[model samples]
Target chain A: MSAVDTRVPQPTTPTPPSPRRMGPDARRVTARTVRYTLLFLFLVFVLIPVYVLLVTSFKPGTEATLTGAWDLPQNWTLDAWREAWDALSPSLWRSFAIAIPASIVSAILGSMNGFVFSRWRFPGSDIVFTLFLFGMFIPYQAVMIPLRQLTSDLGLASGVPTLIVVHIAYGIPICSLIFRGYYSTTIPNELVEAGRVDGAGLIRTYALIVLPLSAPGFVVTLIWQFTSVWNDFLFAIFLSNTRNGPVTIALNALAGGQLTDYAASMAGALIASFPTLIVYIVLGRWFIGGLMAGSLKT
Target chain B: MRSRIRNWGPGLLMVAPSIVVIAVFVYVLIGATVNESLTDRHTAAPAENYVGLENYANLLDDDRFIHSLKNLAVLTVVFVTGTLVLGVLWAFLLEKGVKGEGFFRSAYLFPMAVSFVASGVVWRWLLNSAEGEGAGGLNALFGMAGLDVLQNPWWSHPDWGMAAMAVPAIWQLSGYVMALFLAGFRGIPNELREAARVDGASEAQLYRHVLFPQLSPVALTALIIIGHMSMKMFDLIMAVSGAQYLTEVPAVYMWQALLTNDYAKAAAIAIVLLVVVAVLVVPYLIHNARTERQR
Candidate 1:
């Protein structure tokens, strides 16, 4: 490990080559300026859209137009929000009614699947897990038509419950992938063996040891899946009728196939983005920690 | 024996529900698609007559299908290369261990968590050439600079339109790929780079010889994921571009197949997608199997 013990200052920008060295003050100033500038630029890039969305959503169309999209409004009118909310109410109800249940159901089933795969070293476990991985790669587009036909044949084309089944079916892939990886890495095999040795039954061992241990990862998966199901426009539009269509489809319809309604639509979109965005902000740590938990360990 | 049964039964029972869901959804749906590909079907009902090869032939002949395949190929190539190159570069920069890493990392990654619709909206506003006064964000900025290139309203050519559409996708993804590369980078022990540096090797040399070899597996995984994601891209295309059938990718084209009441054609296109994915994935699985067995 006998590299140059020299803490070489990197080229932060175009600088005259000065004996390939610099004073501590020079280094500190350069590095700090670079860091602060990067942070400021990145923050602006992120916060600008949120600011725009918030300001425009609270203004009437006329005020928004006069102020420009990025400018502050003189009058904070709630009329646009009221309009958006009125239009999106049906969709909000539908997504709430459908996506929430779908996420919970999938998370539970996926977590249970993780427990089985983690605890069992049976002959076919790897294959089964691999099959699930394959499902992850199989784009839903590839099977949308056949799926629609099957649902229709089964005579449950326009129901929330049918959409729930589809959500659970597809949701298993990534959710199960995350949980299985999480359980395998985080939940020690020693604990499971100890439970078995203590004469704990399979149900007891999992209910007591496994499920609680895997809650954090499962929550991340649930939130992610919930956002996806809630935001999905393609399948929601195709699979369900107008009455049962989720917020995404409903909102797209509200756009009414025209670009002129963009300001109000953006206002509607801001509302649509609220719940998921808030969840991401609040649970940022857990969500990221879960994502990195598998990849980071190695 | 009775006690043994009690212990084993509950585990099996716990697993049965998942297996049932997978079987019904995955295997059964696959079977249904395969069957429908060979039939002339409609939304109203399945007309199950074995019209072998006809759907496949028609699907291949359709200009829309061909255009989509070409578009997806271009998109996948451009996106994967752009993402991986920047991803690796970004991770290497992060290796410098600069200040404000926490803030930078989160900022870079935040885009991934946002909905595609919002991103689509942003791209539309930034790239849209509809407004005459150069009202789009980029166009407006370019107007302030007095550069009229952004004034051009051309959306037909792949170079401008497709590449413009690709910008946000690239930005949103590079950080994710960077995260993957960072994991691989961290796994690399400090000593290897230090030893290389002691040998008077430059940073470029160190990466070219030392780091690249060490990162081969992680790079493979990243490429696979990127390839898979680009292959099935629909939402971004739909959000940024709608009603441009020729410019659309395979997934959106398949959606149109469903919309047009051509179930057999849709199934045929899906089977084509499966085949394309298999072409990439089967060999990957085989190689992985060999490597694992070798270990």
Candidate 2:
């Protein structure tokens, strides 16, 4: 009798089949229709510009400017893509050269830092961590002058190596924050205690226990660092010369040149964005999770 | 003492590299910048003597610097509010259960994956405000629809130029804000709504009483993050408009000052930007650390 009573009270059940329900039913339907309509309109507004960019990239140069922005190309061509590749391939390589070393070094350093801060308790540790946290919010412009002097003084005035060093040095704060947040939440101190009880040293415990549990955090930090370092323009422009510039600066120059080729510029934009776009599409859920983890909760 | 040394030594050693690197790159650099800003160094050399508050005072008299500040204020107001409104609306729509939730969600965030430089490239072309038959971008869309009156110069117009830049910004980040809000909505337990429904609460009443109040933290997070991004905005304006006076921001001015070897002024501008960002971010960090402790 109790089960029957509990199961019978679903909200989806008909409300006594009343005739008075007709007015509310119509109103509910109207409201739902309005909601759907508004959502669809907003979707259209969000996507139209992206659609324009994609279609414009496909159009030949003349058609892109001559026809209406909304008009589809009569015939697609790969000439623009080919030209963009030829023009941007060197800087694309440079971006990778700068981004890869930077990501790996920072990830390793950050993982170590995170372990110490999260698992190891010491006097003044919280203050030290807070000091590091401050770096996450310091605008890069503030450090530009000193950074230039430091790089030049070290005989790395303008090149991939300088760019690499700059990125790794600056990437520490955010990377440390991400890793610390991840470890403190998911890897409890009990596990570390277990490893230590087995007579394992600090490095051994980290390598044996924590690292195995840290693959996801590593992926998150890697993706974040790779995208950030790859997309960076200010540091690229400030730290390196035009000859060894990253893809972003080169693309900017290409698009902002005296005679702007609409088709080629659009094509270059698409090409330059394709790498990060692929990462986003493939790992977007985890990427979003990482972003939320870094901001929320703390 | 020996055991304590063994214990503390390893942990400190593991963290030492990051500490040294960040100390050099962040703290030491900040110290150097503050020193540079207070001096009369015009070239790449070290400061000769201190000139207290001279650079900041000069900035007060500088029209271009004042214009940049004004533009920053406009961008911050418009970008922050626009992103919040649109993002919250989108989140509400998604929360109600849309058909293509995954597709729309990904599509919305796709812009964020791309660099601002690339967005600037496409938007620069899209917002080209050529007159007559040469019209392009949104202006071209207007021309096609025969709404000639709607055609306005974007990023080129004297007034509202920075407002135009805010469009690309909102487009890139509104989806991020939406994701933030959607997470908030999902975090609310269904039992709360069920109880409200059992109490015969209307949908509007349920939202007003339950959902809105719970979403306040998410709103604060969004505000702080967006405020920080807007204040430090550089690459987008640089890519879209170059160094045009109409669209010059403090970051751009700082870059230009460096090019002309005006180290003091550049350092001053950088310090100003840093102070603005610190004011917004410090309170949030303190709150975050405190809450983490309670947790």
Candidate 3:
């Protein structure tokens, strides 16, 4: 979830003549320290909730009552973690069963659309692409009514299918945008023309040339889509009955309006948070880097 | 005729898959929703009678809907601004090469990957009332230490809870924004910074005058991304208020409508959300489209 800070490669790509250097202002030292102090305070402010979440997850219900929030746990136990897992495992899987396929399907179709838009220019191509672009503008509420009815009609009601469709349809617009943008940059015109000259038709060229080049972008888009769909709670709750709902629905379920299951709630939360943490530790830089470089190619 | 067929050939093969999928699942479904808003039909089947925007009229007057919409407006403002400011500042700090860069980056980014449901649950414990989740961790420690302000009803108080709701969202989002800004910051020429130093500009002045302008495009990019995110912000809110059957964001509101046999009203809310998104999304998407065409 770290926002990848990427700007245009203006300084590095285009060689510039050497220029004279400037030195840091010695007179501004005290002022700089004050500014730095303010920045650190803000950083601490931002970090407070995280500290709260981590500490609360560790504290026994009684310790939670007795100790202050900022202190390290006096009696930390794995019990909350155990409880959260037992309570939320089913919901997490239900979410994944829906989100994973929905993202894959969206990525597959979106990739194909991107390839076409990037390679062959057709009569209605721009208009259709425009419609897909327009799709990104649409809010979930606008489509919820018809979608709920449609879900029931298809006999996909109250389970993974309903959630899957919600995610897939929503997934298409952004995925296609990223894919198409990536293709337009990485897949050169010369390569495609050369493929055409070799008598390789459209599908053949995609299978051989374009798809391979676009793999990085596709993987990047997949990760992004997976996170979004997995995190979403609206459709899973609305379209599906509780049996097939995601972790979000279950977590919310812990709170019966006024009352909440504190220990069970924190445990369920910790388990649900695992996927994104794993992604950051493993695929962190590439995901954000690929997204910015690919998107900013525009 | 032969030429005409050939011209259409690649289009059919290449574009048809995308078109069919989108049309069946998205475009047509959206069209169906627009139709539903004109009727008050409920229960298992859509009656498809013209109720002449009666649903829209009733929605305009509905207390809960109005309240949610007002709350939604407040939410959008806070969410978009909160994420952007903190996100950009974080991106700056990460980019500027402070100590423990990697550790801090990971610490900040961890919240994002975990499910909001999970994060929401954790935050509830953090914010819940003394009678609710108790002063527990921070409150107990801070309270005993005489930091009494920390013991306030942080989450139970409605306005404060809303801000508290934003805390996790901002936490999850800021790291990503920081990464984006860091990327953009690295893109700037070293000479620019050096030249500012030679000109005797303060670091603050240098950032204000030099780095900030160059980062505008990157900032713009972050703005649009955060806007879409804030628009779809249901999970955090749902977790905060308990769930759809209770707290009602536009998305949750729509969901509840379907659950309670108010399909038309649900569709109306959904459509209204889509329209609001369009106001933000269309321009940015178009800008992206144009930028891509240039590239």
Candidate 4:
């Protein structure tokens, strides 16, 4: 229906009133009620799974039956939380180990690349940047075989270090894209020119001028990279095994185990999601900005 | 001038590391995959003799690969449509100036932060196919509300299982699409809407005639972004259906092939996926680059 129909009623010129029709005020009230009702229904739809996850996770194992999934726990206990933590904590720590360094390294590399592409216009720089952008869209499956071979051949068969390096390499495209967009718009050419006037060379100008103004860009890229690396499953699954793999692999194992533990699985899902959830809640504005900047290039 | 070389030198040095990484990881590896796909390499024994399109031919004839392609087609159509519709509706509602806009926006978008694995694990339970008293999750909710007719074997239905899998995908991504559309909506100047209204344009007419035409670029961006993503979807399917043939996509099949040490076949499947995505994305990327340059 029309969005105008939902608007608040404006004061209208007086006209002959009809007996059969309701007043404009009443129609406006109806529209308002309908709008809120629709929003509430959609809210319910969005929150239903979340409700299931929270409720099921709190239930004791005996009460966490599949048939009773929607039922609130008759007895709430920390058993599931404890079990999920015990199973997932080691890998969670490993994820942290992988995600932190990867984010920082990617952010740094992206900053340097972004500075050059945005400011220092070497010949064929646009072509190089476009080529870099294409890398962002390639399915990792294309690279998985050779990447695995190359890694193992280089004595990096399976570990956090290997995964981190892999992520940083892949992270370069989006990271640089974000930073390039950021620097191009936010840090003016005048600023770079001012640095150059002070006899700062290419690296010096980046260090003295662009780097100081890159905090916001760094924040956006770092948060984006961290969330991606943390939530990554494909790379982790292909690159590392259960013992040293990230939380995603462990959570998959715990949930997809032969004997499913509903409460633990639910708990594990929540536990695995906590870090990125917190990041979104705290820095959601920048995250959305990064997403839009990365995708909507024009 | 000789000075120009110095200017280029440091800039090249700065980007050199990224160039090298992408060269080795993306370009060189793609070359390697292309080469591998033509060979008879199996993990059991490294007899890497060239078979020259044999793997691609076998894939074309393979029932499972064909079925996975069908599944991807269904899943992409359903997923893309679901997210687009819901995303636009929610964005329109928010743009109509709802109170507590921040809360609604956050509530709608929080799911994007959660990993596919986590969401899939929950959705697996929600889409449980059990009927009658064994109903749970959404089915149980339906049963409780006397909406039993709405319940079905979601993600397990032999025919529409891939379509059912789009449900979780929509739930997770619709908010991001909403953000995209909302940004587009807000980008249009308010005077344009006021002018349309003054000219006796109905809200529907205004949207159809003026607003929507302007949103084409944003719509294209969302479509390309969502399209390539659905084409390469792996984690959500693996997490939800666990490699069942009912919802297998090419990416999952590739993973399975790799696991079985079918190196050449997996490489072929991967190259096929790469080609599919490139066909969809490359033109859009080039168009975008050209437009940016003109601007």
Clashes in predicted model 4: 0
Write down the C-alpha DockQ for each prediction.
0.40, 0.51, 0.41, 0.64
| True-structure RMSD for candidate 4 | 2.9
Judged by DockQ cut-offs, the docking class of candidate 1 is: acceptable
> Which 10 consecutive residues of model 1 chain A have the lowest summed lDDT?
A1-10
lDDT (10s digit) by residue, model 1, range B145-172: 6886656543346554555556667766
The full ranking of all candidates by DockQ, starting with the best, is 4, 2, 3, 1
Question: Please, what is the TM-score per model?
Answer: 0.86, 0.92, 0.84, 0.95
Clash pairs of candidate 1?
Answer: none
Of 1 and 4, which scores higher on lDDT?
A: 4
Native contacts conserved, per model = 0.29, 0.63, 0.58, 0.73
Segments in model 4 whose C-alpha atoms lie over 4 Å from true places:
A1-27, A197-199
CA lDDT of each prediction against the hidden true structure: 0.70, 0.84, 0.69, 0.90
On lDDT, the leading prediction is 4
**Among these predicted structures, which one has the highest TM-score?**
4
- lDDT (Cα, 0-100) at B20 in candidate 4: 97
Please report the candidate that would top DockQ against the real structure: 4
Each candidate's clash count = 0, 1, 43, 0
Q: Assess candidate 2 and give its lDDT.
A: 0.84
